[model samples]
Target: MDTAGFTNLLTRPGPYATVLADVSQDSDNAAHAKELRVRAACEELSAQGAPPDVVAEVSDRLAANVRLPAPAARVVVATPEGVAYDQVAVAEVPNQVATWDPLPDLGSWIAARDSSVSFVLVLVDHAGGEISLWDSGLPRPTSTTTVEGDELEHVQKVQDDVGWAAYRMQQTTDNVWRHNADKVAEEVTRLVRDHGHDLVLVGGDPHSVSRLRDVLADQPVEVVELESGQRAADGGEEALHDAIRSALMDRVVRQRTALVRRLEEAWGRGDRAATGVRDVADAFVTGRVETLLIDPDALAGRTLDPADHPGLTFGEAPVSGPVEAGEALVAAAVLTDAQVCVLPASVLGDAPVAALLRWA
Candidate 1:
């Protein structure tokens, strides 16, 4: 997951209250349900010894935030000063998480962000295409725009009448299709370039889909076509979303496999890699970690002393005592501008934490 978004949080004072509440407003009494969840999270924070001001801030933010349409979650990290970070994710939190600790409990937020996919959804036909940008961890697309092709006198193929006229008409139709698909492809390329999306989900008329795919073949992104995904049909959006979810999961698996393979190869080489919490921590402090690999279960009960590592101090606040190892590692990785990959324990073996270093 990209840690760029949380870099500002690292520079803020801690003793943070982290809350992950299911804020889905799809229920009959959504307001009341949300209120209950917010209240419960605040209560958890208070029970965990969070300052009252911070707890109230969290509650207010969670309550006042825009409601999402489907199963969603809101992640809030606050300090006595105020709410430092608050964002809603598309997916729901399986269990509400509220933590009051020396460092923000970012595991839930990170997991959600990592699992949620961001891409461009393009539904194209002979005329044009509707392009929507699905932001990472957001329930809906940030923006939806349409790309319309040039007006053509005739876009249909001709039959029987033989020879020059038929051939000319057929060529015109093919050209029209290519032209429209090219317009969509150009817009898609521009969107991906501007937004940094690595995936483009295209679905619509089969010929249009083929033309767009052909045009986008040279671009550096995965183009997936869903035959069932179309524009404004009965239950089309729901079916499209389902297909997208499956594609995202498959992409995640592939990414994790590739990352693990790279880590293993680097480990075998005995260079440019660090394994176990201690080595990973040292690499993080030195800003040598390019990618931080974590097994979430390995973080249980583990602690790290900020006083022992000067590099761990990001904000002006002094180190009071030990902090959760998971939180500290994530914070350090973000501070150092390194990518964090939470992996399964089976892949990591005995290593609680591992990293592909910037250098040996």
Candidate 2:
């Protein structure tokens, strides 16, 4: 779910197909068997009248995702005229029907690729810190950097000689923690500049996490302290994922709510909101749309002649469509680099598609 890679698939003209298959290997022949299954899926596309070249490329790409070593799952996306996007198993799910949709149904993919949303998770303690960059939406951290320092451990009680030693150890730990934070902040700034992650998550030693915020004060990113065990500790991934999952769930809904509010505000003022498919399509033609919103289940596979129906134009020629209305609007969203948001059926009310326009 690298943004650029996804944009290619989403914005392109169809006959694009998505194939999600179990590529897990159990035996010596497992890899070959997986290849055959994926290849067969591509053949099905060809049989369905997809371009021969596209099918061949798709097959090659799908095979590559599993390759010699087996994968847990595979998602293959191919467009006839554009580049193919193939990714190894990020999440384990059933072998969906080549998971084919007009455009690769990115909903699942986006949801599965947690790192795609752009965030930096820092796990820090007095001894060191770990920085995990979640920018490319890869199954693993796109990049990680660890900063190390003087060893520091807790002394539970302070009594006479033991108290003095404990206090000294604590002081050393504090200094090392402060130093580690500065170094971590420097690395974080570089990553933010290079990767553009907007959210910052911190977990680990509470004191380290607190010191981190002060050092990162000037960095332009939203930093949140998470309650969890550190990644370097046992069951780290699960703890990190649990916290991240909780954070993202709230974030996604808030984002959707904001988009809805934007749409409603524009409509209320009669400034530039396009409500319903017809108006939105017209907005696309005029290159007025800044955000494209749709109900994924509505108006699906519905086709209309540009000449006869309300046609959405992509701010260009072919001002109408015999193209499936849903697909056409998706293309328009991509063409204009507008944000594409799919809302649930109830949230969209009666509108199949809506647009927040760039201009009235």
Candidate 3:
């Protein structure tokens, strides 16, 4: 997910309705049941005063677009404008908790399934190989490409022409190998730029794996060579998944640790940081916040409009019910084109949220 994509989801004007559900079907009966359940759930939200138009739109869209999960999936739907559905298998999406709220509940689920970050899996051998763009929210590859080289083994083995035939065959093989490598490099680079993927895992034949990595070494994202992998449809995919998980997990850890250090530095500076909800909210209104770090656990604070300010306000009670603070800050961040990353409780210390400001 690029900044624009996430920004759209976060900043869409409310009242928003977000739902994550399992719509997997095993039989005709299961499929029918799932369909009815979806309609019923949408209707239930409508009954609870969700926008009639949005509900109608969601219903029609879900009816037309809903797909049975392979085994099971996490299907997320949002209102007004944005992605109506995002899903992946139980093994990939992991936890599935159905939810509907005025705000999109992607906070808890973004890193696990819906984040734009994805792994490019390349399994290459001498003859040919497969490259798959993998994202947790979708059960299969978003894009796939096959890398194949011209056959030269039999030509090399021919004895009639002696060394000459072997030499020519070797030349042709080299050409084919370079051509295939170039194709993989071009496609993978495009995916990294256009689709927001930032990591790649290459496995299979040792020579081929190293060559592919060298091809992508100039790309900014991580390009790792693994011990083994195959492009099988099932069962044989574990190696690739395991390698991807490990690499991405390392990235997540490094990112979180770096963010903590940055927060500490900003706080020490005093002027460029905001720790509590009130201060963070104020920072957002002033357009000072460049990055927001929030704990998904403490997202329920209410921040109401202050009389003097037009954009946003905090630390004031309202005569009427107030907007959820987390949602409000997210909206502000998106509107201001700032970044938001989930900061866990341990790293966040006592604050519900924090901001690293662009300026004092």
Candidate 4:
């Protein structure tokens, strides 16, 4: 996940109040449930010595998403100024955390965002396609568009004749199909490029799928040709939705695996790698980290004194006290434009944090 989103929280002064909680609007009493959750979070922040103004701001911000259904959890970080960083997280928060700390508890927020995937789903046929940009765990697409190709007769195969004249007719039909596919591919590419889409799912007509894959072969994003689905209304059929979700999850797994493999290879060479709290923190502070792999549980309760790292890039305010090590490291990573990937507990053995640095 890109840590740049934390610029607001990092640039402002803290004792920041970070709240991670369930904000799902699926139930009939969703408004009340959400209010209750917001109330609880606010009360906790108050108990943690957060200012009333900050607590009120956090409450209002958390409750503002009552109408957005599933991807039930949200993470909000607020300084006394107002809400700073707010984003919808993965489907659930098994354990909600509310804290007022020297630095925001960013590991939880990062973990939640890391669990989700963003991609473009193109349901195509020979004549056109429906393109929707989606994020896994969210109920509706962020954007939806339809790409229709030129109006041409006979955009499909016809085996009625075999003469030269017949071949000419078939060639025209093939051209129409390819032309339409190109139209859809162009739109898909634009959406992926503009949105920084992680994956592209192409489904529907097999020929159309093949053409789209061909056109998108050189793009940096991954293109997964789904085995099912067609152009339809807002949400595709249940089975199609399931297939897309599965593809997104599979991509997540593959990406995490690849990240771990890269770290392992770099570690084996004993270069471009930093492990344990102090080394990883130093790397982040110096802007040397390319990817910061954090095990939230491993780093829980750890602290980093600002005086120890005089050049910390978190905010303009001077050091007040020790900050949560995970939060401090993540803040530094964000300021330096590094990626943060949350690992499962203990995946890094006893090391609370590990990093693949830009240089040795």
Candidate 5:
């Protein structure tokens, strides 16, 4: 998903520098450090001229107290207080910070999907005193189970059962200095095996996450780590949000590529032609079309042809006449349920045509 761009959005100017100083100057600065870092991150985003709504989003994410709404384009988070909401540019009433309930949010996430069934796995790393998990497919915990013991031993057992499921687990910690780091890694492995999930998320201190990754270097699952502490069931919402974002990004890329390929192939046939709206409209009136691809821009100004063209076959006593170029093409495509590609200007340069109707 172009996370790099999103990550850049979180970058701030002075927060890191001040936070680093606190981390070095005081032993009790851990929590304070996190708060400062989060604040700094938010400030950085605000400075970038991110819409006020987007800025609020970063704030809400950094605050553990509030649960932001699902499918939010922008959110405002207040540390240990709660979250605020806005739509596009209009702000909405904020919700209170309540006990962590992953079920409802999970359900909402799943309902948004067009797919029938999906598998999701949640991985929590309490080693660094943080909880993190990845949720994909199926909202609401279908099953909740726990394992307790020496962290390392438990994670090893999980790995043995899951058979290389740790690779996709996000590395939350980069250091191995956390207490029971090994145990956290073991538990993560166990969770993956017990629940046949498609995605794995790891949450905890940097050190703890590093150790866990080292233990599960060969796993095949997709792992993601969050920059927060373990908080029981609360981590579910965050994990689900990350998984949804990841899934959506992948779907968009795949759809865009497929559409482009179909258009290119049709253009290569040479038999197909797309010029002004009239030419394309004539082709659709007859049954000589297979797929229709339209450039939203092209649709803005186009005129239909009067005469019926190739590929279209009307019933007996056909009423032949010109239709509004853009409207006619869209109507025909919809009526036939033909594949439609909404191309941008760049794609239009190569093929400004709509449907890949029949070959000339």
Candidate 6:
């Protein structure tokens, strides 16, 4: 989401020169020209006493790159303004940081919004019990808690919450089923109320979630039971992934749909002008193109013959020929990789190309 480092690279003379030259009426042309300039620069630097390693590094940096999309994973967990959820990040999981903050004000919500969280995990204490509610998008929390664990396990000592419950079930012969079921139902209902999202119940208790489902059969909410005996916060590595996936389903689908459309439009038209690729290219030339689309397959086998075309005019002057059309298009697409989608053929047919391009 932060492009500070990339921006610095672009501002450097070596890269900026190529970028500036590539901005023209023909985006593909511009892209090809930029790539040429970059390659040339790397060669010159290497020849001018730069270390081989340094030249290779420069070349690698300047080569084909994919731009990351804007941060959209923000999840806002709304609780009482002063309440803080107990949050911890399991070290074994990569690219995940978990912390609980008091939902103090709109400012805090906005600050949290910047995080691009895949899912929001809300830890709430209610009259029923303490439970963690998971929502893929930043949906609101719903629920109340009334039950208490027989013993409170510290974060480090716990490995699997749901597993522990399963162990208990296997050992007990009493009507623990009814007791656990009541508790799960109460906790799930409260979770739905607090988070305002659908529920995926996880824990060591199968009877608990199953019973909870039967009780909530009349409610509008959907409840899914996972067959793990893991605890809410200590469900180990696999559980963590499961929870995050459930929370980010909506966002993931939306992103995938947009990508498919862009790719389809780029390769769909039989004629460039009629299919709108020409118009899109013209937009790129005028710097009106906010996004570009290219087919990776189309690029792989393509070759350009710069010598085939004579002088190509830019502004008021004629630029020498020697540019291949395919090369130019590839360059243009790469230049706007942040705004480009290299999609498969299937995605293109089912999607709206122009809309996806604009969205990008």
Best lDDT among the predictions, by candidate number: 1
Q: By the lDDT metric, which is better: model 1 or model 3? A: 1
Candidate that would win on TM-score: 4
Candidate 4 lDDT, 192-308, residue by residue in tens? 788888689989988989999999999997889886787756436887978887888888888889888888898889999898878887776677899999988778888888667
Ranking of candidates on lDDT, top first? 1, 4, 2, 3, 5, 6
Flag regions of model 6 displaced more than 4 Å.
Answer: 1-6, 13-53, 56-233, 246-250, 258-279, 301-338, 349-360
Query: In model 4, where do residues sit more than 4 Å from their true spots?
Result: 28-33, 154-165, 232-236
Candidates' TM-scores?
Answer: 0.89, 0.75, 0.74, 0.91, 0.34, 0.33
Task: At residue 137, give the lDDT of candidate 5.
Answer: 26
Candidate 2 structure quality by residue, lDDT tens digits, 81-189: 6445777644554334453344454443433443236678888876778998874334567778987765556656656588687778878777867887777778888
Q: Which rank order by TM-score, best down to worst?
A: 4, 1, 2, 3, 5, 6
Write candidate 5's Cα lDDT for 57-175 as tens digits. Answer: 44555444322222121223221122322111111212211111100011111112212222333344443333233323223444554534233322232656454445323232222
lDDT tens digits by residue: candidate 3, 1-360: 123445545434455565544466767886786587667768677776777676766555545534435445444556656454454444333434333455555554543432335678777766667778886555677788886655644554567776887788787777777666666677778778887677788877676666778888888878877655755455266766686667667766777788889888877777688887777777877889888887756664445343324566322212124555665666566667778887765666577788888997
The predicted structure with the larger lDDT, 2 or 4, is 4
lDDT scores in order? 0.82, 0.67, 0.64, 0.81, 0.42, 0.37
> Lowest-scoring 10 consecutive residues by lDDT in candidate 4?
153-162
Better of 3 and 5 by TM-score: 3
Model 6 weakest lDDT span, ten residues long: 15-24
Please, what are the lDDT tens digits per residue for candidate 6 over residues 1-360? 111112222222221111101111125664575467556655655554544554454444444432312122211111212111111111111111211111011111112222233222322221123455433223333333436533332223235687776656555523444555566566566656665555344445444545556777876564444434344456464764565555455454555576554445545643221122444444444344444444433333333332332221222112244332333433333344324433443444422222233332
lDDT of 1: 0.82
Number of clashes recorded per candidate: 1, 2, 2, 0, 42, 49
Error of 3 at 125 (Å): 2.6
